[model samples]
Target: MATLLFHLGRASFRFRWFVVLLWVAVLGAAGFAASKAPTPADEGFTMPGIESQKAFDLMEERFPGAAADGASARIVFIAPRGEKVTAAGNKAVVERLVHSAADGSQVASAVDPFQAKAVSEDGTTAYATVSFAATADDLTDASKSHLETALDKARDAGLTVEVGGDALATKPSAGGAAEAIGIAIAAVVLLVTFGSLAAAGLPLLTAIIGVGISMTGILALSEAFGLSANTGTLATMLGLACGIDYALFVVSRYREERAKGRDPWEAAGLAAGTAGSAVVFAGLTVVIALAGLWVVGIPMLTKMGLAAAGAVLVGVLICLTLVPALLGFWPNAVLSRGARRNSRRHRRKQLRTENGGSRWAKLVVRHPLPVLLLGVVGLGAMATPVLDLQLGMPGDEAKATSTTERRAYDALAEGFGPGFNGPLSIVVDAKGAADPKAAVATVSKEIAATDGVVSVSPARFNQAGDTAVFSATPSTAPTDTRTQDLVKTIRDERADIESRSGVSYEVTGRTALNIDIAEKVQASLLPYLAVVVGLAIVLLLLVFRSLLVPLKAAFGFLLSVLAALGAVVAVFQQGHGAELLGVESTGPIMSMMPIFLVGIVFGLAMDYEVFLVSRMREAYVHGDAPKQAIVSGFRHSARVVVAAALIMIAVFSGFIGAGESMIKMIGFGLAIAVLFDAFVVRMAIVPAILALLGHKAWSLPRWLDFMLPDIDVEGEKLNRKREVAERVPEPVG
Candidate 1:
């Protein structure tokens, strides 16, 4: 294995240019491909039972230009009290709005006249919609112009207008914007932790490349299989988290090698073999955890599952391959002179502990219960807020991060009856034997009886014989307490109506959608959490050949997540630090956030746990006391872990500004999860526990340790220098 790694290291130096060029070409190709890839905005993937997707697909088929590609744009019009929405107002503002949808100075085509449908029951609430000429996926100059005209006219009209829907929702911001923030944060953190920008940039570059490939590849597939727009952001987070994390593993190894005065490429290869193996294993575990989304039996989850798994796989592969290859090209200057010197200083400083077992191992031998108790108590505090968690399904405006949206929602809620902004739909299908009129009447009476419901509109039959749609107004705005309360009331009452009224109907629209999604998500929450924890444990055990080690890792990861979640729950869920993150108190956690949190948190926690224990295990195998090994491993990997986590936080935190509520929550949850794991859990608690556990951590029975084959981290690095000198080309990154 050592011989192969040595050869691989030598080959990397010999074929440095080939590896570097391969990256440039892959990046170039990805960039070009991404340019052509359509943004999936609002489109979702193949989750079964989400009839909304099917319904929308059918709507698109019926009205080819209206709902085919993306969600039809929702334009909300607001007129001052008692201002008759004049026909002039409708024509000059609403009709004219469809004429100027275009790029700068160039008009494309006006919104198709058939596309504009009047959407108000009375004159007070009015709207004109402009459907895209083609699918949002197939956006063209003509379609752009139509959308622009609609937006411009709405702005030009006397009424306040807001353009929303899935198309605009999926807009990918500057891809580089996320990368830049990630890089900047990574660089500063790397410098602070490892104390070198050059050192930081290598990992940052690797992570960026990985993220690029992930997003492009996922999006490209989205075109074929119909992935969700939300998957785009998810891919970004997973890619960055895994990418930087993998690099940290390699970087720690590289530094460890350099400390021994090894050549740069030699150290890089050593790092790849030593830390890289753990990276591969950890990455696979995360991929496996995310892939469990498939088990949820929902298309939305399935789509997110595939995208997340793909992103993690790409990240892991990049870190293992491209990062090692890229490191071959770094000059000795790659490490700041001080870092090199410190490397030497720290190396000798630890000679007493080198391959001599972890300090944690010794501590565990000295006192096990104290360490265990401390960890449990600390984790208990963090888990406290988790018990108070409430689930909420916030509507469109609740998803907005815009100050304007904020001010508007607030003013609307305060000024108008909350019901005006809370849009809920109750549909009766005659095909299902539901009487449209009777169902509508029953629905209306039920809604009116609901404390928070303020108004129930007369039923509007889209299909005269069987299908009818009716609107309901809650006593509060979409974000208001009353509106959300009404959603719960509607859902709770659904069963009774089904039994008594014999009317089978589905309630949909923004508010009901939120509520239903939240309820359904929570229903399956336990199984998902169990699966994630189980996967992490089983995967780790298979790699380590020790039951205790995997359990410890899982416990550490859970603690890390619960601790971070508690803090955020206190802030966001419990209303402690909501103002700091710029989120309004919604009184409950968002429906999808927890599921998303488990995926992200488990991935990252596994990352640190893997990095830390891999080294500790290595030291234990080399005959060091376990305490000495744990503390030493902690010291060695601590800097890189902290740096990697900080970069993740910086990149994710910027997303809080994206004007999407769910996205911001994801960003915050991830940032907090990483920080907590890197610092308190992995750094302190993990070490303390390991300190208390001694050889029990690495102590598998002779039968298991001897019988279980040791997993090689890096497939033994092959000495391909002789072959590489012949100028063999490298595969694309």
Candidate 2:
């Protein structure tokens, strides 16, 4: 692998212009394809093989044009404290708003609150449902504007009005000022690390170009592949972070080679062969971890995982080819001025001085047991909160109170009950029953008597009268545990109901769908972790050629991941310090958050592991003592790892500024995970553990070692070949 990469790097340097132009052409083609592709569809929430999904599919089949894919809005109106919406004046305002809303572009119909019996028992609040002909994503801006105008008229009449539904949900934009801020911080970190503007800017430039290509390609193929609208988000975040880090590693290695008196061209090849090998392995681990999301059997998550894996693959390719080619353009500019001007004797003298990383490594080595204990105990304490973790799909209640959606949700909850915001749809299949109408009525009566059910609407049958649908409102909030139990209770009692009424029923709706999704995701988490972690362990064994090292790395990853989850639970779920982070409301954590955090954090955790541990392995292979190898690795690679981790943290933390609760949770979780993994686990715990184990840390069974392929990830073969060539006497001409 090292030899192959060495040759490829040199060729790219020799043919720099060709490589550069090729990438530019690819970028342009991707842009053109994206421009011509159709807009992505807004598919409704679907969980195939689940009861809720089965109910939804049956509804779509039985009732044409009544699929859940269409957009809908519930405009809630609240009269003055002393006045009832039933009063003549307040009633007039409500009727006018409904009429105006019905006239809006794309509106199918707007129900009158009085006729629909949507008015609250108190007579002070009412809500009208506005149905749209198109899905939320397909709704025109003009239609949204028309609805907004109608809302203003209602407010003008001294009534408090708020609209909530899928129609008003906007797609969150990426690459906003927050991302810009992250990139700026990354640039500054690079500048300080490299001490050369040219060197620092190169990584950022390559990363942006790579991310642009991946994002455009995702956009171009989204419609054809049925990717969700937010598929590009994970791709963008991983692409930029990994691209910069990969390039940074290669460039840092190239400068180190140059400092050793190698020519510019040879330095680039050596850098690619050495650091590039690690990059390939690191990139593969990330790809494997991400792509493993497919095992969970969620289509949206699968698309997101594959898209992000592709982005990481692009970063690896650019690091191997484009980085070397670009290095050929200005070989001397990348080197620090101090290094370029220093004499060989002075350079050697400077290298002998102890650096901070070396001192830290030495201190840990001196007190390995103490350091290990402190790190483990500290992280374990942080991970305690994870035991109480709760998973759910947070709804409008999780949104900021300032959003109309949240306000509307609150108003409805207050007017009726918490469950009014998440009514469950019950579908009855009475096609083979002796009397369909009697069976439907019996089923509705049974459902209304369920413990948690507050009310059941009249059954609305299909044209053939074989299928019927009704709504059952629970007494708890959408995300409440009681609501989930209510859904399960109805399903559990279905057998008895069917035996009595001769009709089969299924429960579905936004609430039930969310419940099912959360259950599925939770069940899949362990399997997903097993697949990702087991595969990564094998990959690490191949790279490091050690059994204990891979196990240690995996264990460290578990600690960091758990700690990160614990932190997320405390802040986002338990509401501790949520106000400081802009969390307006607190509830259960997003169902898929733990899986995402584990997969992504595991991949990035391996990145630091490979970079830091490979250097130590290289030193050990070259005959350094175990303790000395630890110091050598820290001295050479510590600075780059620190800078890369900071860049990743900055990029992720920037997303905290987004308005979307899901995005904010993702960003915050990723940032904290990276912090724990990079600093506490990799930097501190790893070194201490290695020091405690000493030579045993790198040991592999002889038979197993013989079975495993030697990929030479540490570039031992390349260094040996170079040494042999230099030792050979030149032939006289």
Candidate 3:
């Protein structure tokens, strides 16, 4: 593999112009395709086989136009203190708002608060329901404008009005600030690491180019593939991060080769062969972990994972080809001032000096037992919060307090109870009953009598008169554990209800759907982890030719992931230090956050493991003692690893500035995970454990070693061939 990569790198460097032009042309083609492509679809959260999904499908089949799938808004109104919304003036204001909303474009109907009995017991609060013919994603701008105008009029009439619901949900536009900030931080880190402006800019340039191509391609193919509008978010985040990191690795290696007196062309080839091999394997691990999301059977998650994987693949290709080609364009300018002025002997002397990495490595090796115990105990303490982790879908309640959605959610929860924000739609099918009306009435009564039932709306029959639909509100909040139990209780009692009432009913709607999706994701977590972890272990075993190293890497990954999750729960769930991070409200963490953290962090954790451990393995293979091999690995690789990890951390932390809660949670979790995995697990625990294990750390079973193919990740074979050719004197040519 290394020999093949060496030739490929040399050829690319030899034809640098062609390599550059090819990428430019590809980028142009992708941009053109993106320009002509249709707008991306908005496929909201969907679960195929869950109970709520089945109920939704049944409702659409039986009730058609009346299915609870259309966009809806709850416009809550509160009168001034000592004033009742039931007063003549206040009532007129409420009625006017409902009428105006009903006349809005795409509006199906609007229910007056008085007529619908939606007023609070005190008559100071009321809410009107407006239903739209289209889904939230399909609502026209004119519809939103009309609603906003009506809201303004209501506020002018001395009534406080706020709106919440699917109809008002808008996808936040990406302002590009986060990406810019992340890039700026990465540039500074690269500049410091490389100590040369020319070298520092190469990774940024290649990363931006790779991101442009991948993002444009994703946009171009989105409509055809039914990708959601948010699909490119993960793609962009991972692409910029991995692209820069991959290029950083290759560029660092090229500089190291040049420092050893190798010429430009030869250095580029060797760097690509050695460092690029690690990049390829590291990229494959990420792709495998992401693509493994397919096993979860969630369409949205699958698309996100695949899109991110594609972006990482592009980064790998750019590092292998474009990076070396760029190096061929300016060889001496890439070296730092100190490196350029130093002679071969001086450079060699500098390389042998004991650096900070070597000093820290020696310290850990000398006290392996204490270092390992400290790392384990610290990570374990951080992971304790995971025991109390609660997962659920964030609703308007979790939104920023400044948002109208959150204000409305608060008003409704105050006036009509917390359950008002998340009502469950109950669909009763009575076609087989002797008397469908009687069956529908019986079912509604049974549902209203359920333990957690706050109230049940009057059942409305479809045109066929065999199906009826109503809503049931639980006593607890949407994300409360009791709400989940209430949903389960309803479903569990369905059998008895059906037998007695001669009708079948199912619970669905936004609330029930959230519960079902959370449960489904939780159930799949273990199996998904099993698949990703097992695959990574096998890949590591092949790369390092060892069992203990792979096992140790996996264990370290678990510690980092759990510790990250614990941090997320502490801030986002328990509300510890939430104000500093701008979290206005806290409850359960996002349902899929755990799985996402596991999948992405696992891949990235292995990246550091492979890059760091491979260097040690190479040194050991070349006849260094185990302790010295550990020191050599840190000396050569630790600086780049630290820079790469910091770049990733910056990229992810930038997303924390997003207004969306889910994006913030994802960004924060990933940033924390990288911090723990890179510094604590990889830097601290790994060397200590390797030191304790000594030579046994690199041992593999004879039979397994014989069966596995040699990947040549360290370019050992290429180095041997080069050594032999150098000694042969070229036949006097």
Candidate 4:
């Protein structure tokens, strides 16, 4: 196979220019179309599955009065301390803020719905509900700025003001800083990883194009299926991450072959044959893992599964087709001098000699038990911090650092009540029981009395209504341990509520849903991870045709996970790098991050495991003993692993420096995992243990061996391929 690959690689080198040109035209076309592609970050988009949208639609359908008057912007006001606010003073403040909104015209037209409403039963806290001429989704910047000016006018007349809620949160411009940081960090990583200013720039560019297209498609698509705004950003970011990562793998491999003296065409072909094959395998693996999210049959996870899977599949194809075609035009642009060298046999010989290794080798060769035990102890120590991780997924509320909206929520929670932030919404739908209103009120009363209750809002739409979405705040802030505790209290109180004579309620929304999602994921993550690990072991066993190789890889993978988890617990959970990373520590990592880290790190770890061991196996196949093969293989591949790892580390750790709290875990986790997998596990532990195993490292029972295919990555025509691979006169170093 290597002989054929070499010949094909040679031919590709001859036609390198053609291949590079092909890549250029394809990329050019993709870029042109992508530039015009739409994204969902537009003002017209609706927040799907929102009851307010439904209520507004129903109201429009029934009376059309609400839509005609447009919607209201909430104007919150706090009265001065020790000063009593009379009805006249409240009315005066409202009228003045209202007039400012209308530019001195009739105040009703600009703030028709503005009314003095008690935020608390006491007159100390009052706010104006100011309706605007625009739909909730159509609020202009001028309109928003107008509100700001009006608030200033009210403050000038002596009132503390804050403006927020659904309207402000839904602005199309929100999260720009966070998203910008994510993109900028991604750009630098891509550039450095590919080792070319232009080329690295291209992967990120292509990913952005793909994201724009996907976002637009998702918008149009979601309109059909009623997906939400959260899905939009989630899908967009995920599409970029998967798309860019896939392209990087393929493009990097192609570049590697080119650097090895293969012409563009040959490098492309070899890259296709090796890395390309792995891309298909890896892409499929991603698709399968994501698709399994649906197997548990949860709505959110299922949708997420399909969205993520679709994104990865699309990315793989773009990498395979578009990237290759683009490369067809840049022959010497990405190529370097290494490809001109002759085969280096001594390095190959040293690598092969590990299989038949010497006396010093006997230490590592005879100490499998000690190494394995030491590995266990190290892993255990690292895993100790994992017990302290608090699993909580922050919502859209936490996207900003110093945004007034978030700060206002925090301040409100502090002064008004603990649960004043984004808490669970409980909707009670009454049955045929008489006095249902009284029963609903009773449930609300009980909820307000629950432990950790900061306070509960007055029953929305009156206590007796069959449908009520009452807001419940907790003693702790939203998405914090207190809220988590509050959610548990609500769940614990569910049966008690069921005993309410006339009403039944289903609790849902950000707070309750956090607990639900976390519980579901926690219960389900183990199985998915087990499947991932089990499948990986099976795949490695098939690839290496050895039990020991799979076991070794699994051990290395375990160490990698512990090492990452430990570092995460120490830095993020233990608040070690908060200021350095420019993020306030949000204790308890996201539940999904660990699951994601496992699969991703494992795939990458297995990639190195396979690459290193395959070469070692190559040495063993050439008649060297197993000990020599292990040492020589590690010595040769260690630098490559370290180089790739350094690139990954720099790229991911930049996220830690980006000053966004949301992505710190992802960036820091992946970087630590890569470093651990490369140096401690792959470099030291994996080699030591494997070397100790000797011939058993490659041993498979004869009967079982027949079921496996012989994979000669070196080549099919062994002697001929050996001559070509061993042709280089000097070692790479």
Candidate 5:
């Protein structure tokens, strides 16, 4: 693997312009493809085999073209508290808005508030429903503009008018400010680390190139695979972070080689051989972990994972090939003046004193038990809140306050109940039943009497009179536990309702679909964790050539992940500082967060593990004592690990600036996880535990060791050659 990577680097240098031009051509192709790509709407959450999903399918079949792929807009009109919407002028204004909305190109139909009896009992508020021909995400900007223009008339009439509903809920966010800030911080960190404008810019430039290609690829893939809208944002986030970090690793190594007096081309090749191999392995770990999301069998999550993984893969490839070719283009500029001066100073002094990581390693050697205990205790504290973690999906309420969906949601909640925003569809299969209309009416009446049900609409039978649709509003909010319980209660009555009315009942709608998704995800959580963790263990075992190493890594990383989750739970779920963070309300964590976090965090945590432990193992293999090897390895690898961790934390933390609460939650979770894992687990606990284990940390049974392939990820042979080159004495002049 090392030889292959080295030759690949050498060839890239030999044909540097060709390599650079090839990437430029790829970027051009990606841009052109992106421009022509079809935009796919968000598939949302799905659990295909679940009862709620079955119910949804039944409804779709019975009422084809019934806004199945579209969303309805709510045109809310609120009068002054002292005034009644029933007043002649106020009602007229609302009717005018409704009529205008019905005439809009996007609107399939509109329900006049007066006709639909949608006015609140207090008569201060009324809302009309405007059905659209396409989902909120599928609607073009022109269509939304026309719809908004139509709704603008109500506001022009001196009444408060706002548009809300699925059409507005899934609108694309203008959230690049946070991401831009993240990239800026990353640039600063790189500049500080490299202390040279040219050196620092290389990583940033490479990252942008890679991310650009990956994003365009995602857009193109969405045309066919129907990726969720969030995929592009997430892929960009991971792509930039990983691209810069991977390039940083290789560039740092190249600088180190140059410091040792190797020519630029040779240094680049050697750096690629060593650091490039590690980058490949690290990236593969991340991709494999993300790909594990497919095991959950959720289309949205699966595509998200694939998109992110694909982006990271592009990052890895760019770091290995394009970065080196760029280095070859201007070899002299790769070394900063500060680095050169430091090399001269270091050579003159032949410094003997240990740095912080080495000193910490020595402390661990002296007192392993205490260090290990302290690290574990700290992680345990952070992990405590995870026990109280609740998982459920958020709704439009979680969107940014500036969003039309958020304003509309607030209006609906104030005028009606919170449940008004998420009504459940009760689909009745009255086929072959005597008096199908009466059967549907009986079921509707029973549903209205249910404990959690707020109201039930009159049954609307299909053209065949065999299927009926009844809208039911729950008393609680959409994401509320009681709302989910209401879904359960209604579904539980399926048998009783079926027996009494001779009509089968199924609860179906966005609210019920979300509930079902959560339930299905929760049921599969443990199995998914097992699969990801189990696969990580096997992969780590092969790389490290030790059973204990993989076990410790898997277990410790899981602890770090749990600690991160606990932090999110404390901040978001427990509402400890939610208001300060701009979150509107406390609610359950997103259902898919834990799954996504586990896959992402585990892979990221392993990246540091590979970089740190691989060096330690290299030293141990070269005949250093376990304690000495730990110190030497850490002393060398600590700077890069710290730099990389800081970059990741900055990038992730910046996302917290996003307006959407769910995005903030995910950002906070990832940031916290990286911080804990890198600074706490990898830097402290890992060294202590390995110090305690000594030689056993790398121990494998003789039979198993023989069966496993020997993997030299750090290019030990190249290291040996460099050592020899540095040691050879010049002829006495």
Candidate 6:
């Protein structure tokens, strides 16, 4: 593998222009393909066999138009402060807006709120409903424009009109601003680390190119795969960070070789054979972790995992091929001019015999017990919040105040009740009943009498008169625990309705569906955790060929992941510092966040584990005491880990500005995880554990050793040649 990679690197160097132009062409083609791709409708995050899915499917089968296929918006008109909304004026505004919106191609019908008594007691507020024939995601930009225009028509005469709900929700910001911010921060870090504009720029350029290709692929695949539109932003986050980090590792190694008086092509070949190998293994770990999301069998998560894994794989490819090609174009100036002058003066100066990381490792070696205990206690403190972490979708309460969704949500809550924004749908299958309408009416009255119910609509039967639907509003906010309890209450009340009225009841609506999703996701957490953690352990065991090493690494990784999630729980769930990011209050963590974080953070944790441990293992294999190897290995690899972690943090943090609160949570969670894992777990915990374990950390039983295949991630042959060359002195000179 080393020989093949060496030859590949030389070939790329010899044909650098072709390599560069080929990537350019591929990127252009990807963009064109993405531009031509179709968009998916608003698909629920559902698993086929789950109860929530069963309910949704039954609802759609019995009542197709009112189920998951339709989009509804609430248009609220409130009189300005100190003004009253006259009945006639409110009627005129609602009628005009409804008529205008109903004329849109996408709109199916617009209901006058006045007719339904959707007006506040003080006559200060009124709201109308606009229903779309298609799902929210199916509405085109033109449809939105028309609706906005209609909404604005009611804004005159001291009326403050706003639109909200599935149809009028704001799309996430374009993400360009976030990407730019991340790239700029990365450039500063790279410039400081390399002290060469050209060298620093290479990683950024590689990242952009890689992310461009990956996002294009994600967008192009969305239509066929039913991927969420948010997949592109998520893919971009991972792709750009990994792309830059991969190239940075390879390029850093190449520059080190150049400093040793090796020719550019030789340096490129050696770097490709060594650091390039580590990049491959590390990237594969990430891909494996991401792909494992498919095991959960949720379509949205499955597609997101596949798309993100593809992006990371692209990063690996660019690092292996494109990075060296670009490096070939600027060999001598890869480092600062000052560093080059210093290298010339100390041509025979061997590399560092001791560094800061090694000195820190020595301290750990002396007090491993205390260091390990401290590390555990600190991580445990951070992870305490996970115990209280709630899992559900963030609602309008978490949105920016400037958004129409938030404004409308507030207005509706003030006018009617919090649950007015997310009414529950009661679908009754009444085929078996002698009189279907009577059965539905009996169930509706019974449901309206249930505690916590604010109101229930009269039953509306389908054309067949076999399926009857009622909209029920609760008194609490949709995301509130009380509201979720109301859904359970209604579902549990189905038995009584079936017995008394001979009708089967099912709760199906956005809020009810979200509750079901949250419950199922929580239930699946343990199995998913087992799968991801088991995979990481087994893969690391194969790579390192040491039982204790993989175990130690896995335990430390779990700690880091827990601590990262705890940080998110603090900010987004516990409401600490959430206001800094425009979040007004605490809420449930998004259902998929924990699963996604577990997968992503586990891979990233293993990335540092592989890079740091590979260096230590290489030293130990060649000839060094375990303690010495730990110190030496950590000294050499710490800088790269820190650099990569910083770059990832910057990239992930940039997405906090995204329009969706869920994306913000993901971005913040990932950034904190990287920061905690790289700096705290990798730097402090692993070294302390290794220091305590000593030789046993690398020991494998004879049978297992024989069965396991050797994976040389550091190009052992190259190290041997260098060692042999050093041993053979120049006698004549």
Tell me the whole-model lDDT of each prediction, alpha carbons only: 0.64, 0.90, 0.89, 0.61, 0.83, 0.82
Candidate 2 on 1-733: residue-level lDDT in tens? 9988999898888899999999999999999999999877756456687888899899999998788546999899998999899999989999998999899879999999999999999998999999998988779999999998988988998999988888886556343788779878988999999889999999988999999999999989988898767898789878988899999999999999998888888999999999999999999999999999998888888889999999999999999999999999988888887777876764874578478788888988889888888889988998998998888888889888878889999999999999998999999999889999999999999999999999999999999999999999999999899998999999999999999999899999888988888888889988998999899999999999998899999999999999999999999988888888888988888988998998888888899999999999999999999999999899889889999999999988888888778788998999999999999988899999999889999999999999999899999999999999999999999
**Model 5 residue 667 distance off true place after TM-score fit, in angstroms:** 1.4
Q: What is the overall TM-score of model 5 with all chains considered together?
A: 0.93
Q: In model 4, how many backbone clashes occur?
A: 42
Ten residues in a row with the worst lDDT in model 2?
168-177
Tell me the spans in candidate 3 whose CA falls farther than 4 Å from its real position. 65-70, 134-141, 170-179, 343-351, 730-733
lDDT of 1 at 507: 57
Candidate 3's residue-wise lDDT over 438-537, tens digit each? 9988988998999999999989888889888899998989998999999999999999999999889989988899888888888999889898989989
Residue by residue across 1-733, what tens digits does model 6's lDDT show? 5556777777788789999999999899888988898764546556776555676777678776555547888888888786656657667767888889989998888888777777798888888889888877678989989998877777765479987878977776634598579867878988887888888889889988999999887777778777777666557767877788888888888887887778899889888888887888788888878888877777777778888899999998888889889888887677766666875544443455666778887888788889889989999999999999888877787787888888888988888878887788888888878998888888999999999998998777777889877899999988889998888888887887789998788887778878887888888778877787787778788777899988888788889899989999999988889888866667899988888788878777787888888889878887889889888887778777888888788877877878678878888898899888998889888988888888999899999999887666667876677668879988995
In model 6, pairs of residues that clash are: none
Candidate 4, residues 521-628: lDDT per residue as tens digits? 667767876776677777667666799888778877887887788878777667776666655645667767776677567656665676666657766777777877
Clash pairs (backbone) in predicted model 2: none
Badly placed stretches (over 4 Å) of model 6 are 1-4, 15-18, 21-25, 28-45, 68-72, 80-86, 89-107, 132-153, 174-179, 219-230, 342-351, 658-660, 721-733
- Clashes per prediction? 43, 0, 0, 42, 0, 0
Point to the candidate with the largest lDDT.
2
- Root-mean-square deviation (CA) per prediction: 7.4, 1.7, 2.0, 7.0, 2.8, 3.1
TM-score between model 1 and native? 0.78
Pick the TM-score winner: 2
Q: Model 4 scores what on Cα lDDT?
A: 0.61
Give candidate 5's error at residue 646 in angstroms: 1.0
- Models sorted by lDDT, best on top: 2, 3, 5, 6, 1, 4
Q: Write candidate 5's Cα lDDT for 1-733 as tens digits.
A: 7767888887887789999999999999988988898776666556777777887777778877562657778778889768988999988888877787777776788998898899988888888888888776667887777777866777787888777766765544333687678767877888888878888899989999999999988887776877766777667777887888789989988887777778788888888898888888788888888888888888777888889899999999998899889998888686777455666665653355477778877877789888889989888998899888778788877776777777778888988988988899988899999899899988999999999898988888778789999899998889888898889888888788788888888888878887877777878778878887788788888777899988999878888998999989888889887887777777889988888788878778888988888878878888989989999888877878888898898888777887778888888899989999999888888888888898999899999988988667768777787689879998898
C-alpha RMSD (angstroms) for model 2:
1.7
Q: How many angstroms is residue 381 displaced in model 1 relative to the true structure, after the best TM-score fit? A: 2.5
